[model samples]
Every structure is written in structure tokens, then in C-alpha cells.
Target: MSNQQPPRRFTPMSQFATDYPVLLIDSDAPLRELHNCVSERLNAALKYLHLMACTSLPDYAENDINTVTNIARILVQDVSDVFRVIEPRGFETLKSQ
Candidate 1:
């Protein structure tokens, strides 16, 4: 008598569509504009840092770093400007009152 083993059959589960929350942003809105502005500045800084780290060319890398640093300075100034607009100091305070 020969012993025969039965092959097991596998059944695959059906793929179900998953629902995900969608984030919608208005392109013409201030929130989207601010997001875009911040993204661009940060991307620029990251690219400059990447270039500086990857290349041994100090002349070019130094310039790139400097450019990023300048952009950072400008961003800082922008923050200060926004702060001023949001919370302007009184003239007396400015005059050391």
C-alpha cells in the first residue's frame, strides 16, 4: 500500500478598499500660501546643506551654505515683520517709556 499525501489548497482573501481621511487645502488661501512659502524655504536650506556635505569643493559649498544662511536670516526677518504686524508696540514703549 502506498501512502499518498493530499495537497492543501490556499484561499486568498479579497482585497477591501480602505477609506482614508482626505486633507483638502485651498490653493488661494493664506494657509496654503504660508505652507508653500515655508516648504520652499526649508527645501532650499536642505538642498544647500546636502550640497555642502556631499562635495569637497569648499569654494562652492561655502557659497551654498552662505546662501542658506542668508535665506534663514531673511526668514527670521519675515517672522519679525509678522510679529510686528500682529503685535505692534506702542510708540511710548519704543521711546523707552
Candidate 2:
């Protein structure tokens, strides 16, 4: 007697979304405007960080620390807004047209 084994076939499951949520971009604003907003906020944060007077750690006062933290918060909000609108690389179709 000869024994023959059957090949198995499998079906793929639907994709599941990641659990993390992002701060949503404003629907009323155009994409160009959103881009400008994100860029400007990031620029503002960088400008404050580059303040020459605060070059050394000892130069930072309590108010300076608060200002730096507030700038960081602004940057986070801007980034979260951006991530809300973009899709994962492989999951999206690449179009050249």
C-alpha cells in the first residue's frame, strides 16, 4: 500500500488596526495649512532650544525650564497630528501617476 499526503491550503485573515490613538488633524484646514502648522510649531520649538543665552545648564532658570517643556508639548502635539493622517508604508499602494 502507498501512502499519499494531501497539501494544506490556508486563507488569510483581515488586518487589525493598532490600538494607539493620535491627535486628529483639523478637517476644516487644508493639507497645505496643516503642513505649515506642523512645520512652524517645530521651528518655534527649535528656535527656543537654540537660544544662545541658555547654552549652559546653570544658565536655565525655573521659567526657562517651563518654557522648554511647553515647547516640547507643542512639538508632540504637532507630530501626533501628522501621524493621524499618514498610513503605514507597505499597507498603502504606491502610485506614480
Candidate 3:
């Protein structure tokens, strides 16, 4: 007999959508505070990625490069929302030179 596993079926979120928006609305902190925390972590992750990207190129593979690029794109997209929180909420930003 061959050693292989059967394909697994994917389940849609609609299968568990009975509660809708109200189910997961609870959180320990306010939404704005959560947004700020997420932004800070994303910014730190981007900085870490920058450092890794600057390191020796010979140690990385084609897949590693692609993975890093994709993750950075996602982090940047989420981080942009931080600006929405900061600016409209009257937080200070550094002036560009």
C-alpha cells in the first residue's frame, strides 16, 4: 500500500456564523487601545524584518525571500491603520525634514 493521506475538505466561516458580530465583540481593552498595541507590535516586527533583510544574502533561499516580502506587506497594511487612529485622535507626529 502507498503511504498517502486523503485530501482534507475546507470549511467556510458561514458554518459557524450563528452569533455574527456580537459573539466576539468582547475584549479586555477598548478597541482604540488594542489598535495602538497592534500598531506598535507591527512596527517592531517591520524593524526586525528590515534588519534580517539587510543581513547576508547567501544564507537565504528564494522561498525565504518571498515569505518575508509577503509578511512585510501584511504588516505594513495593518500598520497603516495606526495612522488613522493617531491622526484623528489628536496624537502627535514628527515633522518631515
lDDT of each: 0.47, 0.55, 0.55
* Model 1 Cα lDDT, one tens digit per residue, 31-70: 4454455566566657755765786765566777677667
Off by over 4 Å in 3: 1-35, 91-97
Candidate 2 residue-wise lDDT, 1-97, digit = tens: 7587642222121222445433345444455675677677778767766773467867779897787777677676665555444323212435532
The list of candidate 2 runs beyond 4 A from truth reads 1-24, 52-54, 86-96
When 1 and 3 are scored with TM-score, the better candidate is 3
* Candidates ranked, most accurate by TM-score first: 2, 3, 1
Work out how many backbone clashes candidate 2 has. 0
Q: By summed lDDT, which 10 consecutive residues of candidate 3 come out lowest?
A: 8-17
> CA shift at 28, candidate 3, in angstroms?
14
lDDT of 3 by residue, 32-67 (tens): 775776668687777979888788878989898888
Each model's TM-score?
0.35, 0.48, 0.46
Q: Give per-residue lDDT, candidate 2, residue 25.
A: 51
Q: RMSD for each model, in Å, please?
A: 24.2, 12.6, 16.4
Candidate 2 has an lDDT of 0.55
